[model samples]
Target: MILGTVLGLIIFGGIGEFSKSQKANSLGQVKYLIGVSYPNLNGPWQLQMNKEIKNEIARHDDTRVIFTDAAQNDEQQVQDIHSLMSYGIDLLIVSVDNASTLTPVISEVYKKIPVIVLGRGVKGYDYTLYIGSDNQLNGNMAAKEAIRLLGNKRGQIIEVEGNKESLQAEERSKGFRETIQRESKHSIIETINGNWLKDRAEDELKNLLKSGVKPDLIYAHNDAMALGAYQALKQLKIEGIKIIGTDGLNEESGGLRLVKQGIIDATYITPTGGTSAVQYAIDILHKVPGLPKKIILRNHEVTKSNVDSYLTEGDNSSIPFIKKKERKIKLGFAQVGSESEWRLANTDSIISAAKEAGVELILKNADYSQKKQMDIIRDFIKQKVDVIAFSPKTEDGWEEVLMEAKNAGIPIILSDREINVEDQTMWTSFIGSDFVEEGRRAGKWLVSDSKLTTTPLHIIEIEGTANSAPAVDRKQGFNEIIQQNSKFQLLQSYSGDFTLDQGKKWMKQALKTYGTEIDVVYAHNDDMALGAIKAIEDYGLKPGVDIKIISIDATIKAFNSLKLGKMNFTVECNPLLGPQLMKAVKDLENGIEIPQKIITAEETFDQKQSKKEFSRRAY
Candidate 1:
């Protein structure tokens, strides 16, 4: 038998001898085939798992293992499994595509080779061990965190569920629903299938928003889906909605970093599946019995308080703020110029922040001109900057510039205003305020305050630039609230063009025509309100005393005015976007794809609150 084994080794190489030794030694070192099913290889979890599986295969010197990626197809995965069995593989490891459809294939494979299911499991399978995190536990943990964060508030939740067909998805949804059901106080009013894609989630969320579903909390099965939900919330301008998700992969930073940055409230940890699967296969190969049929790894909840410990080495602050050792990267910026003081501050902050962060910035002022911005972008392409950052002056007229940037192999970071660019593949990520939420907060506040009043209040609105995104959003948000109130009415509205001069001129004319009938002034920005205040003073009407003033963009001037009782409420629009921009650039350089949009955290301030923080104010 030994001689025969040696001869087999000589004839068919080491693989043949390994097979012979398996039969002789009674170790049962059967040839095993592994099949991986994934939606995309671009995500962090898939990439990590692929690397781990490959490493495990290298370590298994005595057994032959065949690997295949199903690439997110149920039929393709079944065919791949059939092909593997045909190659004489003794065992099979499968991460299923569709739990239900793959049941038949798993049953078929089990007749030939013991099938071990990893990450996700199929029904009617009892052939092999299962190793993966408890997804149901993940859902429960997410719900606990959501309830803890919400405290006493009872509101509707929007569930961003994973792919409807996957068992993991079903299990997670089941867990979440069970937990919410147990609570009895809170309810999941609607659940949208995200299909485990960010873009898909965003679309579904946007549709729900347009249909007027007011969600107080959003729970996504995965971090990417959560990010998509965040984008939709921002675009629709919904405010005060808590967002949570799962998955804690290190490479993509997962939802942990998002929570730290206030983009998400929380995320649950889902262990990577590859390493566990490989270990299970090896245990079976060695004839190790008494192995637990099912291994469910515990889930961990990650929140803002404990996220810093999980920050990646590159993101660690111990490293100098900017990597001074590397070649200086030239960055181009196309900005929305002087739309508001906050806009100006945002531009200045990026320029200063990039420098502080050790990047050389080549600044270009679009001056709120889309044509000029396009020209500047083309010039930046000619200059071959490493990366480009721009705040689109308008939603349209950006595809050409974005295409040109993409052709140049330059990654683009969108700041503030979002573009109507159809090919989302053009930009790396967006970092800015939740414009719609800002509007919604303004609206909610207006409604709450107006509810206390007995008499009807006539309001004149000072709108932002006609074409600007914030202008359109702020108007929509204000009207969404005011229209619902019977005691509040908008007497007149005019575009201030986001300029003090335009605001002053427009207000003066409205004052001349309407006289003292206007009870309040709502400006899209603080600069415009300051101008409106001037117009009010010129007309001999006490500014805040006679006509209550409310505006967005709590610039220093605006806050100071609020403190002095000249402005009633100034919603904060912080222009400090430098940190997020630099982080995105670094993440891209490290080969990580950024999410579609990142909405900055914001708040509202009245005269009373402004007085407390006036001394510590930065902008």
Candidate 2:
């Protein structure tokens, strides 16, 4: 078949004279050639195929094969095929760039040499053989699995098709739609094209979200697309969306590894085209005929329960050591500085948590200075710490420090303050509260509990550190809620820098400025509220009597003050880091990967609830 294709190419003047001359001269030599569909080397599919092709070539003692990446260009692929044929390659393997556009090229090559097409098959052409997984069946399997895991509910499913122009993508969507239809209970609310690239898939998914399409289950044609969809869900702040995809490669790392880590629900097996193509090429070289015209590998679904089966010890293992080694882990911490009571509590918790976890902690205070934090990080590098943990003073200045740590092969974990680092490759993970959500909860509680009168209620806010992430996020969340209710008006605002003395100083100033105007005081942290209480009492205003109080960071002092009726409401920002920090460090030491962010669960508390849960509170 390949010989016929090559003859057609020669007759049509597709092959250059130089190629023809080479074909005539190298007729007796053992030559092999492979034509790949896309030139993207970073793509998992391309990398997998490259590995298998190289392995197959190494197995043959007298064979030499030249590889050509068509880079998803049809004309370039046709030219590559002709050049390969001209080189007198004994076996020709081709993965089509475009199934339809490459048909003529495949037909021409098939006339001169055996042509085995990899991945998506070409139409209007008969070849020596075709090898690829049944994409449609894989898609159907993914839908079925998603339905089964989702209890066959009638929730919306979003199908992310790869390269809408590609035949495989069309087939996959068809099978998925058909399967959902047959299930009767399942529904597909929307479908978007991912283009089989992570960045493009994420952008498309984001656009879909903006259009008000909320998907319960996101099914992508490939793992890369699935991961992209997951990222979109995270960015949109949508939770409980189950994601599934195809290509069960390695579950311990890469896309499959993410699946095992509970990032995605499952993945279906779509055998790498490279392995089968190379195997078939070798068979043809040995004069094997009557090979299957179409080769389809069985599809296997990989879920969390069975993910470990696909992860070999050597393949997905994070730690190479079989036995536990007693090595000291030098740790560096760049705190948000002692700005708020919560910040101090968080810092103290980290120190205490490390001591309890048995991790050698090398602490550094950024002094709320980004430059100082960067310098501290450099010091940590000089100390050669095994791991570094930091709560960046601000979001932007840590890139240099992060790079230095990265270069030194130190894994960094973020805590408390969220640096504006978008690169997931930089840090191992983050562990802290969802500051925005925490603020939202605080706002909702305040709005729900406050007594509504005909008069607009006056509120005075004592904010934490002005530049800190939590302060910004908490303020934003509070404003978002307050804006929804016109009855609630912020009379005045002042930053106490999260210190008791500053809070007292600001409260005194506010009292002198807005005498009887302030009816309620909302402090970002409890310590600030405690200080404000002293000022209120000093001004002959009875605590929790003349003006109600609402504060966050339900520390022990905050709870105790609530019991004394000094504070009206205290949102629980449990500072108990022993359990969570220990778990994170242990996982890292054991070479077990953790999630990118670990949000500590929290709840709101008022005087009534605070009294009931105070004794049980660990922090």
Candidate 3:
């Protein structure tokens, strides 16, 4: 098998050359030593994950990987990581056996080197990047398939679960139970732990059957467990109970083959993301642009109808549903008003990209009003546009209008912001910068820059529009870092509405109230930072010298200010998302699924780097 061949290479330490340069040849290509930590390699799923990571790393010549297995023991995993650290590995790729027990150690290690988490993630955003399939969605898909298999009649289900310590198992079961209860006439009557083993599932099923409880359907957390239940049914001369499972592996003895042989009724394709982990590790090491904090792999359901195509095509979920004649995709984009240079650049990028991609763009500006944005979306729905994209004014109140778009069969893509909705599947994907990470980068710059003194530093913040995703997330991310250090003191924050006028007004008030007491000014965007600079200069104080200024949204204006030594630091929040948005729209039109979140590449700049980087700024 491919996995077996890869395993042989991994064991023998026979690294190969790159099959294809994954990215542009990075400068200063250092031979990096990489460490991989695995929970266990006991099952086909685990083995496949290991194989993919090893195979991907083998393609790159400038990297060497050393792996350690924890044998499913959390303590042993901790020890394995410590050993890997002792080797001074440049990066760490880990799949935790248990999140709760391993998070502290992983968090500690992240402070030193980049950590890429796979399968299960740690407690907080302590790692560099995470690549995994959504486990909750896995259960949701299984429950959906169960409802379809059971049809109209109410059905009783027996659920065979994985290890109790596994967060994936808990989330999968929770999603399955909650979805079945809320969306359909189905009940999970009996829940038993199979410990993620086929034999265990078989033994547990025999006991459940002997107890004289008959279920209409059996749902297992994995394909092995589902196949185990099938074995129990065969031994007891029982039939007619539908089976659903997760991890639709394509091997001969895997879920795809089993379903093809009429063993399991349905299975969800839960990707391990092992190859993605390695590929993204290289990207992170190379400091690639436009990398997201999280990459949620797409998952789909496989049944008798599409299993053959799924197996044959490998990645295409369903055969492109009856091909339509080539036509321009009409994309309705409801933008947050051109409040600043960043917003205008974002709008221009979208328009230009739409033209380049041949998409018929129906654009509307919300003018900084959530109500107006909702009206625009309603209008788009009425117009029956092919796709609707919007940068939400606020995170709330979007669920209802988004539901309207979803019900209208038009996919919604969130641009430059996010929304608070009960069902996240309401939107197809979110494409933007990680506002939280941008804030974190700003904070990190302030703490590390040698110009800032060790004494207590007083900070005044000029914020964006209230309740907006960027404002809220940026505050949380910045505060998370600054709160750790006692030297930084945040005096007061002013709400600026992300406008230069409001920023200047608030800065004037702050200058009158606090006077020369403020040592730093943090603005959410470039216009606000410029406004603060004007306020400081008007108050007879040099902007970047007297008051260290930091801001987000690294626009050309911000870059120029950085070069002029007016703004000390500016975090880049790229507004040029037109290319990515158009690509996603075209992919959806072609019946291809995109990731749940698509983050733009961003960076930070100081005065020294501004001149060199200024010429390359797209926004």
Taking all chains together, each candidate's TM-score versus the true structure is 0.52, 0.51, 0.67
Residue pairs with colliding backbones in model 3 are 290-601
lDDT for each residue of candidate 1 in 299-408, tens digit (9 for 90 to 100)? 55677776777664333211112222367777888775776678778877887889888878888888878899889889989998888888887777778778877877
- Order the candidates by TM-score, highest first — what do you get? 3, 1, 2
Clashes of each: 2, 20, 1
lDDT of 3 by residue, 451-515 (tens): 46778889999999999999999998899879889999999999998988888999999999999
Model 2, 1-619: lDDT tens per residue?
Answer: 2443444345322454423223322334334444433424455765677677767655654455556665555677677677676657666777653677778878887887788777777763357766676677677777778778778468788888876556788888888888888885878888888777878899999999999887789988888888898899899999999999887677333556877889898987576667667766777877773234455554566778777766654232221111244775556776657766567667777888788778788787877777887888788889877777777765665666687777777777777667765343466666676677667777877788774565777889998877777778888878888889888899888988778898899999999998778888988888899999999999989878788888888887888888889888877665554456556667767776544455565667888888998897655
Order the candidate numbers by lDDT, best to worst. Answer: 3, 1, 2
Which candidate, 1 or 3, would have the higher TM-score against the true structure? 3
List the pairs of residues colliding in candidate 1.
237-436, 237-437
lDDT of each: 0.74, 0.72, 0.84
So what's the TM-score on candidate 3? 0.67
What stretches of model 2 exceed 4 Å from their correct place?
1-326, 339-348, 615-619
